[model samples]
Target: MYIPPSSTSPSAQTTTIMSLKTALISYFTFFVVFVDLTLASKHHVINFRSPTLYPESLTWDPSADHFIVGSHRHRTLVSVSSAAAVDTLISDLSLPPNTTIVGVSLDHHRRRLLAVVHSTPPLPIFNALAAYDLRSPHRRRLFLAPLHDPTTDRPIANDVAFDFSGDAYVTNSVGNFIWKVTPDGEPSIFSRSPAFTSHPVDQSLPHSFCGLNGVVYSRKRLPPRRPIKHRQNVQSQRR
Candidate 1:
């Protein structure tokens, strides 16, 4: 057996190693290409044009085949179709000047659209919510309400969610609280967690921001399994 140890040449071993390297490179390239194509097929783009409107939040209307966007600049709710048709659903609310709209949600059962409105100027005020009646004949009925918190000074209405019973819940990013609004527009603090509190300004950067930002609700449904209470959670987007 020792006499036949040198039967294979060095060039033959080098060629075999080169073949394996090439095969590995080919497999890696194919995997990357497959993943890229899979992701690309799942998403697409839609475009619209509104010169004065700076959109911050969007919600889709499945019944009408259009999307509603909240304007931060014009302070309006504009509708954009899939074919790029743009129209103003509600021109303006009774809010103050420099009001910016953020999160929006549709209440199908209540036939209303709720939007989070905040003011930007010398002093920013983010404690307002606006509701529009979707079933109105004129299509412009507007209602504005303020969310108040005596414990925390800064209350920014960031996002909104609804439950099975048509009650609305909103997240206050700066105040670290959740507000509940009834169908009649009455607002009260739902929950306040100390976890959303931010550090002192003097101890950190002057522009540091923190608190609860987004909220969502999930309802339990089962035929014979007795009706359970709806569960909700607040998600903070801190900086």
Candidate 2:
């Protein structure tokens, strides 16, 4: 008596209903399953386990055909396969023991994985942008650039975006700014705006201190400006 969400024909509807029935029976039998209805005619379910590994950010690695996820609780990066297998990809020893991995970005062109690492408030100690060599057998640590100055207020390095020129931009949710890391691993504040500080009128809202959580880069070019001759003509007419 189950109904499908959408179907193009009666036969398709019947198939979907049967699939749901089977999935329900499996679920009752103690199997973890979820129906993936990304495609109208196809259904797939994936179940993965990583005890106490609360992931915060995930990115697809097309070359590996799997997902790279950053752990919020474990301070590690792991890869999840289609078959529900999990493998630790990066766990740097240099980072503070209490820090968490917040964001992950894959630079396929440069064969590197970028990550944001920071400690939460109440005694925040570490904040940095880290990189790993994806092509290396050991997944070697490429660099770790601290995003905040020791004299400044503690900032939470949250997420990252990579540009075509090999520059990595990281967001500071606590400081309301962005950090730019060069290809050679130098870190500097890239951007800040007064608008980023403006908050909702409702002060009771949660997590109001957080700002600039995510970032992205676009490669599109702007239209060319009009020729100088056109401006000269207008100025002469004004005279």
For residue 199, model 2's alpha carbon misses the true position, in angstroms, by 5.2
Q: What is the TM-score of each predicted model, taking all chains together?
A: 0.68, 0.73
Candidate number of the best TM-score: 2
lDDT of each: 0.78, 0.85
Q: Which stretches of candidate 1 lie over 4 Å from their true place?
A: 1-40, 123-126, 195-207, 220-239
- The worst-scoring run of ten residues by lDDT in candidate 2 lies at 31-40
| Local accuracy of candidate 1 as per-residue lDDT tens digits, 1-239 | 22242676888767777988999999999999999999889855678789978888888888778899998786788899988999888867456777888889988777789988876546565577778888887666455778887765666678898897877899887667889988777888888766666444453755455467777888865558756444422223231
Clashing residue pairs in all predictions, respectively, total 0, 0
How much is the lDDT of residue 25 in candidate 2?
92
Q: What is residue 89's positional error in candidate 1, in angstroms?
A: 1.0
CA lDDT, candidate 2, residue 197: 76
